[model samples]
Target: MEQAVPSSSLEQSPLQQVQARIAQAARIAGRKAEDVTLVAVSKTKPAEAILALIAQGQRVFGENRVQEAQAKWPDIRTAHPEVALHLVGQLQSNKAEDAIALFDCIHSVDRPSLVTALGKAQDRLGRKVPCFVQVNIGAEDQKGGCAVADLPALLEQARSAGIEVIGLMCVPPADIESAPFFALLDKLADDSGLPCLSMGMSGDFEVAVQLGATHIRVGSALFGER
Candidate 1:
């Protein structure tokens, strides 16, 4: 396991590098770098590291597992009360209720039943939370996402069920350039009237931004490998 850096060192260490990447991406996109939200994927990473990033003004974060997040959320929330947490990993139906209680956004929702589950969970929680339609743009059998053709109907169903489908999320094939997949998601979000496109990661965020990614999920690139 990786130990967390002390607050002082973490505050000074990697923030400049993160800011530079965001600046470069924004320049390429012709948008202010400040407009792009960077979500540090913090799964398996210690809470102290999260505090270091929060000290540098990074607010949004992504977690891959509900259990891991549950373990970290309250402690981390005590450290940074305003941080936005996104569920960027596969969500099991059994865990939907708990996820609804934690995440500010669910980024890997592909099934209709999951959407229904979220709606019911939100009703119980008495809040409307934003969601993303995960698209398996790579069409990988091992991946979790809706078929590209089914997104329209899924969005419609989501809207009617009181779950807001705000955009799309995808993990492209490792060997393929991410721009095409990002473009496909951009087209879908635009055509569907969803303004946010949550795509890309530490590896190919530059390509994602050029292709109109509104939010980026970066892990190793920002916090180093877990």
Candidate 2:
């Protein structure tokens, strides 16, 4: 059995602040606060930061790298059985099996090969992990998401491969107004009949929530600058 972290209000403040913001944003959107799930992005941060948030009662967290998450999370999850892990970074088809065994949700299913790999891994593991198709909403050449025009076909492939796609994900180009991009993702998700929208980060989560984000990947706001 794993021991829980010792509690402290000071240590819990960051999580509280982010949660409050989520609630506020949800209200502004005329949506229930409970409808939004906050995935505290924990990539590149130390285990202590995660432990602190765990102590603060945060159970869902996001990681960017499979290897880094593999290095830290097993021990942490051993201590906290209820925790849910999400993969919020680009995924390679070769890493499908490892990722299927580790993450509860995969937020970067962008291409057909990766989709097929994840499908095979899920069948082998006997555990179907929910996925979110990442859309290149801004059409940035450097991003990992699929082109907006390619989403429908990619989604069809994921479904054909027996992958359960629950939502859509995106990382808008940095240092720009993200509201329009967020709105675009929401529309795309709606058009695709996806029930969840995994948008927003530490900086613009509130705007994202206002624009209908179902899952907000917040890092610095909850764990403080890594």
Candidate 3:
């Protein structure tokens, strides 16, 4: 596991380097670098690391658990009011209300039940957070995304329940060439008429941006291994 760095060291260099790489990849793909949003994955990382990134102008962050985010982010957000928090891990239906209260976006809405729960939460809270439907592009049994065949129905269900379905998200199979999977996700987003694709992580985010990823979740590169 990688440990967190001190806040004093969280300068613009790390973020600048990543941004430069993203720009290069986007240029190669004929897309503007500004079109891709970099979401710093802060799972298992300390609040200090997040603060450091924020100091460097990182406005977006991804967290893997509702409980963990709840423990640290409320205060953090209070200090940095412009930050946007995203839930990028498997979310239980029972935590819908809590998730809705904390996150500005959700990238793991992969089932009809979660849609219903989130819709109800939105109605109750009078807030509509953008959501991304996770697709099981790799068909991995252990993954949390909706199966490829079930995507359309799940999307329709989410829309009908008053959830704002903004885009599609996926985690490609690990230890394999990811461009093909990224391309597939882009194709799926195009076919569905969705505008956002939240794929790619620390290792393959550049490839993901080249393949039309609108949002890339990066953790280790920004923080450290965990």
Q: List lDDT for all candidates, in order.
A: 0.86, 0.92, 0.94
Superposed by TM-score, candidate 3 places the C-alpha of residue 162 at a distance from the truth, in angstroms, of 0.4
Model 3 gets an lDDT of 0.94
Q: Which candidate has the highest lDDT of all?
A: 3
Could you arrange the candidates by TM-score from highest to lowest? 3, 2, 1
The sequence of per-residue lDDT tens digits that candidate 2 reaches over residues 110-188 is 9989998999999999999999999998899999999999999999999999999999999998999999999999889
lDDT for residue 38 in candidate 3, whole number 0-100: 95
Candidate 3 lDDT, 1-226, residue by residue in tens:
9999866546547788789889999999999999999999999999999999998899999999999999999999999989999999999999999999999999999998899999999999999899999999999999999999999999899999999988999999999999999899888899999999999898999999999999999998878788
lDDT of 2 at 80: 95
What's the TM-score of every candidate structure? 0.92, 0.93, 0.94
Q: Could you say which candidate leads in TM-score? A: 3
Clashing pairs in 1: none
**Residue-wise C-alpha lDDT for candidate 1, range 134-198, written one tens digit per residue:** 99888889989999989888988889889988888888889767788899889988898998888
Supply the global lDDT for candidate 2.
0.92
Model 2 ranges off by over 4 Å: 1-12
